[model samples]
Every structure is written in structure tokens, then in C-alpha cells.
Target: MNIQELLVTGTRLLKEKEIPTPRLDSEVLLANRLSKDRVYFLSHGDERVLPEVERSFLQDIQRRSRLEPVAYITGKKEFMGLELEVDPHVLIPRPDTEILVEAAMDMLKEKTGFVHVLDIGTGSGAIAISLTRYLPQVKVTAVDIDPHALKTAKKNADKMGVADRIQFVWSDCFQNVEGIFDAIVSNPPYIDREEMKGLDANVVEFEPVKALYGGEDGLDFYREIARQAPGHLKKGGSSSLRSGVPRPRRSEGSWKKSVLDP
Candidate 1:
């Protein structure tokens, strides 16, 4: 089949399965298989896909029909303009987390000398790597509870050429992290048990549960971070945390909360 035919067939299959963003998913999957940009389809509609390519494309469509995320299928996701590797072992980077990264950047941008950052639950190293890439004075220590997630994050750091700037550690929410930092950033799991049940199959089924569940209520990680952050943050240091709330809130106590928008 040709480019247009393949996309139409894929779209139809996804629609039948009730997958959201059927057409876009089809285009993205086909583009990934062809290693060509989506724009290529506009001018090359009649171009025939190779037999192996057609088979692989159809397989990807089947995976999507089963509700697998396109990022997981492609094994790649773009965050803060950097293409990072992704898999089932790590949570796929989302656009919402960019707000957290921007907030951290704002906190560190004004600092003069070398600035240290601690990234808790740094799955895929999206938060850690982006900071070092965008801020020349920043170096990050990224920690995660899952070793597999750490491996994936480490590979992404290497892929983005920021491995030297990030130190990957196996820790569960600062259990193994030491030293004070100028800034602490995290897009920790904030979905409570109830919300987890309501998440789409595309998310609940494909993404790692350890990266999504935030205990009985969505504020478990937030509470823990707030409690321990003061001990690790430098005097007047800031924390940029992602919460499941509607608006950002500032902490009135020892540490400041950059509780960003949901």
C-alpha cells in the first residue's frame, strides 16, 4: 500500500477501536516507520511503502488499536524541544511537565555561579537533562527508585549529550540523595488510587504504575517533598513541583512550593 492508503487504513482501524486522535496517531506511526516527516505524506501520497515497511506499519497500527501510546510504540518522545528515548519502563514525557521545567529554569536562570539541581523520580531524565541543556551553570543529580527507569533516563541523557551534566542515582524520593542544592525539581506521581482507576487505558495500561500512583490521595509525594526539602535546599532555595491541582500555590513554611497548574 502507498502512504495515503496506509494512513487511511490505519486511521480506520484505530477509529474502530475507539482510540483518541486516530488520524494523528496514524500519521505519527507511519512517519516513524518510514523515518520521514509527516509533511512527506502530502507530496508523496502515491509513493508505495516496501512490503516489510507495510507489515511493520500495520503491526504498529494493531498496537495502537490495543491502546498503546504512540511514544511507546515509536520509543521516542519530545520534551522541551529535545527528542528523548522512551519505553514501557519509563513514563512518557508529557507537555504538562514542560511547565515544571520552565519554572525551574526561571529559578536557576538568575543565579550566578555553578548551580546544583536535584531531580527526584527522574524518569527518562526529562527534567534533569532539559535544565542542564538550557542552563549552562546547572548540573543535576537525578535519582529514581526503579533501576530500569534509571537506565532509560541515563540512555536519554547520553542521547541528548547531557549525560556528563547529570549524575544518575538509585533513590526513592531523596532516600539516597545527599548535599544541599540551589534548586530541587520534580514531576512526581500525583495521581491518587481513585484517579488511577479512571485514567485512560492508553495511560494506565502502558505507563508504569510506580510512576503514576501517589498513594491514597494525590498529595502523598507532595507532602513528602515539602517535609524533606527544607533540609536539602540551600538558604532561600526554591522547589518547582508538579501537583494535580488546578492552580499553583506558594508554601508559607520552610520551603517554597512552585505548585504548578494542572
Candidate 2:
């Protein structure tokens, strides 16, 4: 079908499936598939899509209709202007996460020396990669419990050119991580059972549960991180936990500040 016709049909299908931002979603999926800018569709409105490409594109649309994330379908996501590879085994990096990274940077900006950082549950290695990218003087060790997620994070680190700087460790919280860090940063799963039920169908159905649900009280990871931060951090080092407060609603990515010095 032609560009206009394909977009119209795809948008209609997604709208019927109750997908939010149907037009934007259709545009991104098609453009990313074709390796063209979103504006390409408007410029080539009458151009026809190949039958095979159309089939693939339509399959992606159907997946989104089922509430599967667009980032997972595309296998890529942008965080802090860095394009990182992603998959279902890891959670897609969110914009709010950049805040935590920025917070860490702000605190470390004036060190005038090398520092060690620990990134917990380092899915896709966004935070670790960003820190290493911007702070060449510093070294990072990223830890994740899931083997699959750690593999995904390592792949991203390699692609982002910081694989050598990050040490990937398989650890449940801090059970296996060793040594002291200048700071500990983590965005662990913090959803309770009640919060899980209210998450968007996309998150609840498609995202990994262990990466989202904290425990019965949602503060399980926080408490665990808090319990371990002291033993693992150097003097003046603090743990930054990405707050999962205000439940699973739209305003969810806000950081809840917790300062612990050891």
C-alpha cells in the first residue's frame, strides 16, 4: 500500500486496539523499519511499500496493538541522547532515568579525581554507560541479578564503547558485589501487587515482572539497597534509589530521595 494508505490503515488498527498515540506509534514503527525519518512518509505520501516490508511492518503494528512496547519491537531506545540496544529481557530505559544519572553527575562533577560507581540492576546499562561516557576519569561496576539482563547490558556497554570500563557482576542486590564504591545508583523494581494491577497494559503485560514488582510492599529493593549501601560504599558515598512512589500511574518515574552515608 502507499504511504498515506498504509499509515491510515495502521493508525485505524491501533486506534481500534486502544493504543495510545496511534499516529505517532504508526509513524515511528514505519519510519524505523524503513530507516527513514518520520518526515519521509509525508514527502513520499504516494510511494508504495514493498509487500514483504509491509508484512513486517504490519506485524509490528499488531504487536503494539497487543500492548507490546515499541522500543522492544524496534530493539533500540534513546536515553540521554545515546542510542542503546534493548530487548524484552531488559526494561526499556525511560527519560526520568536520566534524572538519576544527572543527579549522580552533579554530585561527582567536582571530584577532580577518579571515582568508582556501582550501578545496581543495570538493565541495558543506560546509567552506567552514561556515567562512563561523560566521566572518562571514573570507573564503573554494573551489577544485575538476571543473567539475561546482564548479557543485554554487556552488549550495550560494548556497543556504547564503555564495556572495558564497566565490570558486570551477577548479584542479587549486594549479595555478590564486593568492594567499596564512591556512590551506588539503582532503579530497581518497586511495584507492589496492588500497583502492578494498575500499571498500563503495556508495562504489566510486556515488561519483565522481576524488573517491575518489588514485593508485597514495593520497598523491598529499597530496603535491601539501604541495608547494603553502608557496607559497600566509601566514606561520603551515598545510594540513590529511583523512587517507585505514587504507584504505577502516569506520574510514576519520580525519584524518591534517600540519603545514606557510610
- Tell me the whole-model lDDT of each prediction, alpha carbons only: 0.88, 0.85
Query: TM-scores for all candidates?
Result: 0.94, 0.92
List, residue by residue over 1-262, the lDDT tens digit for candidate 1. Answer: 9999999999999999999899999999999999998999999999999999999999999999998999999999999999999999899988989998998898799899999999999999999999999998899999999999999999988888889989999998979999999989998888877888899988999899989988886667777788788889899788888776532442223124422221
How far does residue 127 in candidate 2 sit from its true spot (Å)?
0.8
Candidate 1 residue-pair clash tally:
0
Best by lDDT: 1
- Model 2 residue 208 CA deviation (Å) reads 0.6
Query: Clash number for model 2?
Result: 0
Off by over 4 Å in 2: 247-262
Q: State candidate 2's TM-score.
A: 0.92
